[model samples]
Target: MSKRRLMNTAVATAALAFLGACTSMAPKYERPAAPVAAAFPDAAASGVPSAPATDIDWQAYFADARLKQLIDIALKNNRDLRVAVLNIEAARATYQIRRADLFPTVNVGMNLQRQNYDVKELYTVGASVSGYELDLWGRVRSLSDVALANYLGTEEARKSVQMSLISQVAQLYYTMLGDEAALKVTRETLTTREDSFKLTKLKFDNGAASELDFRQSESLLENARASHALQTRLRAQDENALALLLGQGVPSDLPGGLELTGQGLVAELPAGVPSEVLARRPDVRQAEQQLIAANANIGAARAAFFPRITLTANGGTASTELSGLFKSGTGVWSFTPSITLPIFDAGRNQANLDVAKVNREIAVAQYEKAIQTAFREVADALAGRANLDEQARATAAATASEEARFKLADLRYRNGASSYLDVLDAQRSLYTAQLALVQVQTAQVQNRVALYKALGGGWTEPKAQ
Candidate 1:
């Protein structure tokens, strides 16, 4: 046979061999069973209205205009979220690189050769494919699968970061409102006590009130002043925290937040079935993708037991004279195929396969743990939802009653019908009750924000502009 005919037959045989190598050694994939309760305990009994949390857009879920504005700014600017998105972009590029390995790479080259023995010069020009691996054992395909899984996992991670940033912005905004309310209360209390102190001092000077009464009045006035100063510091700190989340200094013209009691967040967030809801959570999805990646690694490790085949080929024209390189009868071609089979490696292939399996097992545990953690967060948020509203309501009623008692006690002491100690105790009780009510109201609002995040409410696929 001529050299050309012989080369054609060899190429055909290699093609046929590659066509026969279709089966993968990778084990079939099956998702592990969920490791938690079927439904959120008391999710329905918590009186939350029944609607898919995911279906509610963030703008509607947090109805305050200022809050919506803050969330918009955060999604656009938060540094952590920006990094998460960039990571997805990087993973996608890596996956593209790995996928290209399934096909042969082509190159064009020119070369000149001289041999001393023959005293001849050869010129050649050709397109070449060098050392392209044939996926005879599915090693390349498995690696591609691993890369794809990682890319998908990174996308899910970006969503997780977005959800956290939205909730953080809302929570910090509510805290600022709560502090503002407390400051208002302290200022009013200070004004009232200051007037009372003046009256007590005047009465003491007139010999109608004892020095003890004057001293008690002075103490209450100072206490309110101190509380006002502390609340001033706290509110400023809350603003600074918000600025960090916004990824810039707080805007001088930023709109004020709704009162803590008036924040219009949805009172009830439906958790649905734990298994179903957990499936939608980005963190849980990310963990499962990681598990899939580990499983794909096992296929690559198992492929090591089989032969690795590589093919190299070049075709062009060669002639002693450069001008004659492309002339008839000057054409040259070469095809080389190589195979590598492991004979002995101190059991390295087996050890690698074992490591892959162990990693798969570890991934399984992490997947389940992700589900468990999501379930716990949702349950905790639901418990807060069920109880905090009632707590705030009861605390508000107590505060009102204490305010009335203080008025009565002051009147009685001014009439000389009661000791000044009763008035002092009444003032302290009213002040404590008012602060407690404000704190409970803050908790109720903040819990709504928590439930929104725990249920994976804030993020959606950004629309193409």
Candidate 2:
């Protein structure tokens, strides 16, 4: 055959082989059935219904301006979240490298040499493709797919981190508000007790009140002092925790914040079907991506059982003299195509395939567990929503009743109708009731934040135009 016809035939053969490389051995992926209940257990019991948390933006869900600012700061400055973002960048770069392997790498170069027996120099210039695998069994492509899945999983992980951070900041901020309220109540109680103690001491000195009355008043005064100190310490510790979540000290210029009782968070977020809610959760999506990567790895392992083909080619001009390197008569070209067929490996490929299959099984388990976990969280949050409102109302009523009882007891003691002991007991009861009310209100608001997070509400932000 003529040289031109031979070259044409070679090109056609290469084109056909390249086309054949598109076949993938990976199993077709179907999402596994959700391993939880069809709907949340508490969804039906909590008859109150509202918008799904997924549709509510966090900025709108949390009514407190200060809390929104704190969330913004945590998203930007938290160290754990920063690490998650960096991991995404790193995974993207790794995926880019894997994708680059699909294409040939061409390089241009020059080589110079001199013969021992001759004064003339040999020169060559060429552009060559070296050791480019033809991917006949889709090994490289499968690996690329694995990398892409991993990259996507990393992105989902970042979203999960952001959602958790938002929830944590809001919860901690609410807790701090509770602490402050409790501390204020304690300080007021302490001031009143101190005044009562001084009045009792003056009456005892004038021989108008008995020694027992003075001693009881002194005991109450000391107890109030201790309670005030305890509350002060608790409030300071709460502020420290809030600062840690904020990733810095609490800003002095923060916007006005709602009291724990006044934090009007969206209380009645809808809990959709388990499948729908789990699909939106970032951790669950991350797990599914991991399962996809494992499936792709099985394809790569299976492909290893087949032959690998590689091509190395160079086209250039060579001349004994440097000036003639590009001359038409000096033109030279070479093609080297090779095949590697596994023959004597001691079951290494089979072991790899087995390992890949086992890894895929593990990934399947993990994905299902993620779904189960998401369902449990949403269910727990829904239960909290159904019950916390009543708990808060009951606590508030108890606090009010204690307040009225304390006032009546103090009035009776001043009129000589009841002993100071009755007044002291009522005062203590009122203080305990007040603290309980603050705690229940804090929990009420925190439960709302939890529902928002469990339903995958906080990770999304509007993209800039």
Candidate 3:
């Protein structure tokens, strides 16, 4: 046969082989149905119209200027968030690399040879494709799909990290405010105790009051002083914790915090339908992406049982003299094809397929767990919602009544209408009630923050232009 006819045959053979091997062995993918309630408890049972938390804008949801500023700093500087962003870049790069494998790589090169047995030198210039694997069984495509899924998973993971960071900053910021408010209460109490101690000491000096009365006043003053010192340390510790969350020093320019009563978060956020959790929660979406990657891996494992085809081809001109390398009629070409069939693998392929199946099952479980955890969190937050306001109101009333009782007892003691023991008891009750009131206020505010986060209300997606 003529050289031209042989070249034509080789080209046609390669084309036919390429066209024949294009079928995929991977199973079709269908998202697993969410395995939880169709709607949140009260909203479902009572048919209440609930607003979706996912639709709320985060800045509007928080509504605190200092908190928004802190969240900005955290998104910029938190180490975990930075790592998550980097992971996305890495996963995307890996997917690109795997995708490139589906096509042949062509390279150009030059070579010169000197024979040891002969005194002549030969030169060759060529274009070649080296060991290009043909993805006839969709093996490369399946692997590329896996990498793509993982890349998407990484993106969702970054979003999950962002949401968590914002929630943490809000919680820590509120805690610091509570600590500062508690410290203020202690300082004011200390000042009142100091004035009372001075009066009692003067009465004792004048022999108008007994040593027991004077010592009792001194005891109350000392207790206030100790409490003041303790609260001061606690407030400082809270500030330090805020610094850590900010990933830098707390800004001196930060706006004064809202009183627990003034934190602008709504008392309750509507928990939307439970089925929406699959689409709204970042962790759940990440788990689903992971499941997709595992399912793709099963296709790659199945492809392993078929033959892998590869081709290595080179075309160039050869000459006895370096100057004649590209001369006509000096052309040379070759095509080499190879096929690998796995006859025996000690059950490695079967094991790989099994592992992929098991991983997919595990991912399904994780996905379900994420929904269950989110459901429980929202339910717990809502459980506190219906009662916290009433609790805080009752505690405040108790505090006010105790303050009145203490004032009346102090007046009666000075008038000799009651013993100092009654005054001491009233003072103790008033102090306890005051502290309890502060705690209830803190709880009412913190519970709102918790509900906002549980409902996935703190992270907003940028509007599409």
Candidate 4:
């Protein structure tokens, strides 16, 4: 064959070979299917609220000044949250490394060496060259895809941690409020019981009341005082907890007591749809990103079975004498194109493929479990909100009734128509009812916070896509 025709044929054969090599392994990325629940579990089908968008605007959701401040501080200063942010940065760095592997590496080095020949061989001062390979059965690219997905998953995890921190700080702050309010109630009851005890003792000394009645009043007074002391300790512990969350010393500057004036139940829980919940919840999204990464890995492991093609170049000088090292004859260059094919490794490839498949399945299960857990949490919050609302309402009504009954009993005892025990019983029942009402109010507030957390409201929305 003539030289031009032979060259043309060779070029055509090389192009076909390259194309054939490229076609053997392909992308195998399919998102795993997720199960769909009709609505949140135990939710009444007929009364189910319409789903809202999963993406909520945080600035609009929490309008309270105190709540917003606590969230901001937790985001900025919480140690765990800061660590989570660092984890995201580290993952991003890992992705960059994986991506850089796709291109050949060129390195330049200066070398000086001396060796003396025993007799037959030349003494040498020598240098050689080397570069790395990217044999694209897309191993590097597929691995990069895995790193990319992992980076994204870490970002979602950071969000999940941030949301949890914000909610926990707010929840603890509210708890501190409740403890303060409860302690105040106990102290006031202590004072009231103290005065009653003093008056009963006076009445007994003057013969207007019996010794037994006086002792009973003293007993009640001591019990209330004891409860007040316990409440004081509880309030201190909650304050310390709040301080630790804020990453500071527990300020001794807590309020002397709390007074509940307008503090009460929220008007209603802003209900949204289940679909929105999936989108808004961070743990769910984090799990899904993990699954995506695992799926990408399957492509990577599968690609490993194909032949790896690499092109390398080495250019440097070697000579027995240092002065002659760079001379034309001493400087040598070479190009090597090589392929590494797997013949057999006793099922290692198959085992890797199987492992990748199994991991994908595991990721699918984790994703499903996350969704299920999210659903359960939302359902629990909804039920708790409703039940606490009813409880507060009922408790408030009973408190009023008990207050009225105690007053009637007091009037009858003063007019000498009722026994001293009746007055004692009435006072104890009244105190218990009022205390229960306070407890219910605190519970209602906590329930609102839980519902906010359950609905995934505390998270800062990711910057617009």
Q: Please report how far candidate 2 places residue 416 from its true position, in Å.
A: 0.6
- How displaced is residue 2 in candidate 2, in Å? 13
**Model 2 misplacement above 4 A:** 1-17, 44-50, 206-213, 463-465
List the candidates' TM-scores in order. Answer: 0.92, 0.93, 0.89, 0.80
lDDT of 4 by residue, 1-465 (tens): 233443454354346344433532324655544465656653442343433323444444554555555556556677888888999999999999987766555555555554466433332332222334443566666688789989999988998887777667766766777777778778877887787788778889999999899989889988998888888998889878766776765445433332332433243545555765665688888898888888877777888888776656545565656577666566544556677899998999889888888998899899888877787777887787657767888988998998888788878877889877887887788778887887777766666666666777667663476
Q: What is the lDDT of candidate 3?
A: 0.80
Model 3 clash pairs are 21-136
Least well predicted 10-residue stretch by lDDT in candidate 3: 42-51
Estimate every model's Cα lDDT from 0 to 1. 0.86, 0.86, 0.80, 0.69
lDDT of 4 at 409: 80
Q: Write the per-residue lDDT of candidate 2 for residues 104-166, one digit (tens) a residue.
A: 777899999878886567898876778878887888889999999999999999999999999
**Cα RMSD to the true fold for all candidates:** 2.8, 2.6, 3.4, 5.9
Span of 10 residues, lowest total lDDT, candidate 4: 120-129
Backbone N/Cα/C clashes per model? 0, 0, 1, 2
Can you tell me which runs of candidate 1 are displaced by over 4 Å? 1-21, 45-50, 113-121, 462-465
TM-score-wise, the better of 2 and 4 is 2
Best TM-score goes to which candidate?
A: 2
